[model samples]
Target chain A: MLTGAETEVVLLSFQVAGWSVLVSVVPGILLGWLFARWHNPARALLQGLVMLPLVLPPVVTGYVLLWLLGRSGPLGSAWHSVTGGHIAYTTAACVIAAAIVGFPLMVEGIRLSVLGVDRRLEDVSRSLGRGRGATFLRVTLPLSLPGVVAGAVLSFARALGEFGATIVIAGNIEGQTRTIPVAVYTLLNAPGGEPGVMRLAGVSVAIALVALLVAFWLGARQRRRVSA
Target chain B: MIEMRTRHSVRGFTLDVHFESAGPVLGIFGASGSGKTTLLHCVAGLLKPRDARISVNTRMVCNRPGGTWVPPERRKCALVTQEPLLFPHLSTRGNLAYASGAKDALESDSGWKIVDVLRLKPLLDRNTASLSGGEKQRVALGRALLSKPEMLLLDEPTSSLDAELARDVLSLLLQVKLELKVPMLFVTHKAGELMALADDCVVLESGKVISQGAPVNVLSKPRAIGVANLVGVDNLLRLEVLRHDEAGGVTLLAMGADVALAAPLCASAPGKTVSVGLYADEVMLCLENPAGISARNALACDVTRISEMGHEVLVELKIGLQSLRARLTPSAAHELGLAQGTHVVALIKTSAIHMLG
Candidate 1:
């Protein structure tokens, strides 16, 4: 039922959210396990830094990303010196914005799940002549899969809804970085955009509901595993 | 062979345990919070000690002064804890296969023997999450064995189980120890398990070795205050089986040269010497040779020693050359006017005698 432009916007949103989740998942799992298992004093600092995006204002976070990736900024200058390409106000910048805003949610979900895994199981694995890495892959990772999946889905949903960060860093370029939320905002600004707004809003709600249902299912599975 | 001389202190509880056992299974016996589990963890390489010199099969695992320390996975001691923390995501077969990472090897002699010995073939394809507690433990044991460990470290592996289940698991462990001939470090609070499983034992009391030797020898004496009851044998009577009345369901046992008692029917043949375990509380002391009582055995004895325990008195009785201990309420002792050198009759029920092979 959607027009070609609306379909493109919808596909772009999925692409950006998918990429954002993909970029955050591996690092999120590693960070989550580290936070759950490591007891070093610096762990608190690392945890706080990881959680900063979750508590910080999204607009402020976007502004910081903008400065970091802007043409004159140090990183952006380095990027220009190497690849000779501007990252800010691009589709790549939109993905970065979505990833940054959604990373904390992903990490938090995975961390809690990793924490829920019994350490005795790891000890048993080690005693069975399995090294730390192998034990993690064979036992810890599989056991914490529910949490990992839930975290990824939640992060994808968060990435889909990301607005302020995308607006500031990616600049809502039509047909390029204009995701569902950005498209809705743009349509709202136009004189006769109420119908378009309702359509996109409904789609957004549908995606969020699906993500939430998936997360709930995964969480229930995790609880069953634990009880078992 | 297992050698561990370690000292680790945590929150003011200093654990200083030292022992060396070359026996097939060395039982570490202790109550809760007595550092038994901690000691096992040190041997398993799960806990780093403040200082340690540990060796397994003559190979040095950890030596603080020598600066040689082998990590857990390489320790070659497969630890099976109380709870079978099997990988919930894996099937029983998968868990077994995960240990050695060889499905074909498990189908081979050593691994197949483990599966067969643990009776896990039927449950192999079932998910670990679906197994019963005893079944889970069996799978855990099977998984540990699949690694072909040099030794097995069992930390109260059956403590969480009920008596029947615990016995079942213990019997399986016994089978493993006998069939595989794998040396084991069996840590337990159950006195019966320690006696049945270990050739040698080290009794820990508050992180210190109170006694270390054969379970029979070490447990015979009250190693520490309030330990005899915990040992499950307050009085051990070395009795010679004279005869068995199968029709009557009773066995006549001779203590030393003269003292005799009737015990419940046992499986031992005549003229065989067996150790009989009698709990102190079960031995009743009477002021006179009481008749008309259904109790089967009553022997006249001289009270050799009277030691006061919590709310009760442990009366050490000497009947001829054999010694017996009876726990009497303080009021009974007062009523009977009991003291060292007093003559009294020790009454015991025929079924109360437990034959210890």
Candidate 2:
């Protein structure tokens, strides 16, 4: 009943989500800041590309990642030799897939928060002898924290639900690679697995509800602060 | 010696403003859409004109051709716009502290402290958005002062407030001018308020300087929109010169009205004509056409139009071959029963007459 298999999958979900957010946070914040402040040559193109993960089928995205990271594939072969390891069927592949999908959501949230801050306040800061860096640290970042938090939380939730990409590349190894969605699919596929289905469904619902509530709380706080 | 030279083209309008002056308080007097705010933006280094050079006390904020430029924060000048723009996230006290820098041990003595300066100690914990317009502007003023800026750019700071609130904001500004050595440029179209506050004025018209000088000099020009419409210059009378005294002073006959100047007229001769200006406030309205009064040049007239303007009512009278404007209290008008087509006497003292070109 208390098998290590279920625990490992749950633990694996956390690991993958953690790694995905860690690798993407910097690029996400920078891209967000860029989108909020500067207009570049590829701004529209970049915006479109960032949203592609949401619009495209998850299976197609997972296949593309598989092709890009397969042992015989161009980057995969080079990465394998350099790191003395294979990327396919590994936990790292799950993180890469999750991050690839979750990046845009995080960036968009941070960008919206930054855009909401008053430019006039920045001017006021400049007149007060604070340099651009100091002003960003003191005023801009503080104001944008709620949005950043919301974005990160949303990204975590997306990573938690990631299924197609993980199965295609990382494979459904029971104790190593199988996460919540993969486990749910397997339970539904087996005969007389109604008890397992009911148990896993309960856990999934709890996690989704908590993540949604947290996102809602953050959004409400941001609205009150910004609108005021 | 501060100067700004710029050319910024925006669709139908082109802002080409250039001026250099050393007045303690200079009012950028103009009508709406006259490029007053644009000029202030350029000065504040918020918007760099296409090709321009702006210098304030040897600090070169912009030079376009050679690519010399400084950002707004480095400009060390604060702009107080029609809206206070206090940070909504901060309290009134926090908003004041939002721009406060350079806190030394002797902070309370430098005339800018969170507690002592704004008188916002009570509203310290209250959200800035909840405060009154005057309170917010006061907070904004306090915020700007805490920055210890070299010059203050106030763009219609009290325009958003009611009369009582505007008066309160103005009183605070007056206090700043007297206390600190900070120079200020206030943009407004109200000449009466400018008269009550500004030390000097630059009259701008459709993005050009029609006149710039001492407040009295610039406000007295006959062709000046500054004096004509805004100040309600009562007797902007155009007529022939009647006499010239041996001393520098000369006298002119304006609209069949005798006017004498303390200074020599531009071209004082028998037939030489010039315009003379006198404020309606200066031209007293009298009930009886009393003779031998200390007031010179009393004209028997009829009150034509009476309209309310601020605290005073402007009484337009068709006086001595010309219609003239005169300001009187509503109580005074009520007491006198000032109405249309009522015969009355207008009094203009020789001292109150402003010789104009």
Candidate 3:
């Protein structure tokens, strides 16, 4: 039977993307809400920092990651101290590197949505005897969930395509850190390149379309419900 | 009871309003940016005012100098702003239940569920998005009621509605007051709204409560001159000297039409243009120019503009040099078919003209 290497690569891509998206949501929402509600002196600076990975060339971002988590960096050493030098060249590193690149997408989407939310609604909620936390949870958060969903999908797509950063930070290893993009890159550099590239490209396209459709469907449903 | 004495400076506007309300329904009347809603917010514990003192049913919710300020949720004070602002995410029933009093919030026997008191069981599952303005207000009212607030602070609850819708909302408010027996601090500038719902009136101008009393007396008296003007008083004219009557009442005349003015009017020289405001309610509309009538003041006039204001009509009359407004039943307007340049009579007694400084 012919090997289904494309399926394996696509599955690994989804795994990394899923982990990246899931890990970043709580922080993304928190920061988005903060940026929306407050007028801090550092808002511009903080926003710039969030978008840095997006602006930096993915290869540059990847190299920076390699330098920061290459066994001797402060975070790398602490992680190594606990996990016995297993921080880099792992699926976990791929997820983390992809998440860092996707953080800006998550933050900006949720931030714009949060800003668009009607704050008067929250005040009315307070007048209706809802406390601050309860009002945010029941009214504010639900109202902004559509943006969160959109952000999550974009983050997942970006994470799935993260090649340069993932390779530099995690060092592609078969069936572990080698996501679809990295596997395709590796294959294209080898003798039987076209077949692997074509196969992985098809898998990538399918996965991206499915994820986007599902994300938009969920977001639209939630928004329609909110409006309804 | 709804009592507030506060001074809160917000941006450039300074809100300094002090008033007390124990009436089943109380209204704060003011123009736009006149600080009525700020006063309401202070009483609701939504805004903490400097040097403020607030009490609701013997419970002091705020004492600013003493650093005692109950948070809004803890205060059990509900507010309905210009918009009904019913929770869009919730159904009508869900919104009402959202504010229902916790067991800890109740000290007495008033623990109303969504269905029993508001009669909202039928609307429980119905989405609030589709409710009409009046229905949404009713739901908002129900939500506020179910909260078991000691006092309700309503800021222009019906201001968003048309006359018919406003009447419906006001009647519901009256019903809520009657059924719940809870005091309400309602704030609005609409004269009709205040008259419909409020037993006591607190009139504010430039963030100060200049007049506060029973609605009719405060509204009709000379001390409440500014409020009367703000309420669109029809007449504020010059008084001319007329022959003093044998009864020792100085017969001061006003307008091209003769009407006696009560004497010893503040800053009154016989020739002084003493501004006496006459509310439209004080004016009488007659179908004919009768030869003899018990009404002391009668003047033949032509109709200017007949504005249909709800069930009633506001007939503006051009009598000699003055224009007078008369609030008449639509039936009267329909009976006369009063329109532009139609002959009519405005018989306003001297005693009916409320004098002011």
Runs off by more than 4 Å, candidate 1: B231-258, B262-275, B278-357
Candidate 2 chain B minimal-lDDT segment of 10 residues: B256-265
Give lDDT for model 2. Answer: 0.76
lDDT tens string, model 1, A1-228? 687889999999999999999989999999999999999999999999989988898888999998999999889889999998999999899999999989998998889899889999999889888899998888889989999999999999999999998999898888789999999999999999889889899999999999999999999999888777
Residue-level lDDT of model 3, residues A1-228, one tens digit each, is 115776777778888899999999999998888888878889888988888999998888978877778788878888789878666898989999999999998888788778767777776677767888888788888888888888888888889989888888888789889888888888889997887788778877877898788777866766665555
Q: Candidate 1 vs. truth: CA RMSD?
A: 6.0
Tens digits of per-residue lDDT for model 3, B24-100: 78888777788888887777666777788888887888998777888877788887777878777666666766764
First chain TM-score, candidate 1? 0.98
In angstroms, the error of model 2 at A162 is 1.6
Question: C-alpha displacement of B345 in model 3, angstroms?
Answer: 5.4
Report the Cα lDDT for residue A158, model 1.
96
Q: Report lDDT per candidate.
A: 0.87, 0.76, 0.76
Q: Which residue pairs in candidate 2 collide?
A: A126-B73
TM-score, cand. 3 vs. native: 0.79
Tens digit of per-residue lDDT, candidate 2, span A83-196 = 989988888888988888888888998999889888877766776666778777778878888888888888888998898888888888776678888888887899986777
What interface root-mean-square deviation (Å) does model 2 yield?
Answer: 2.1
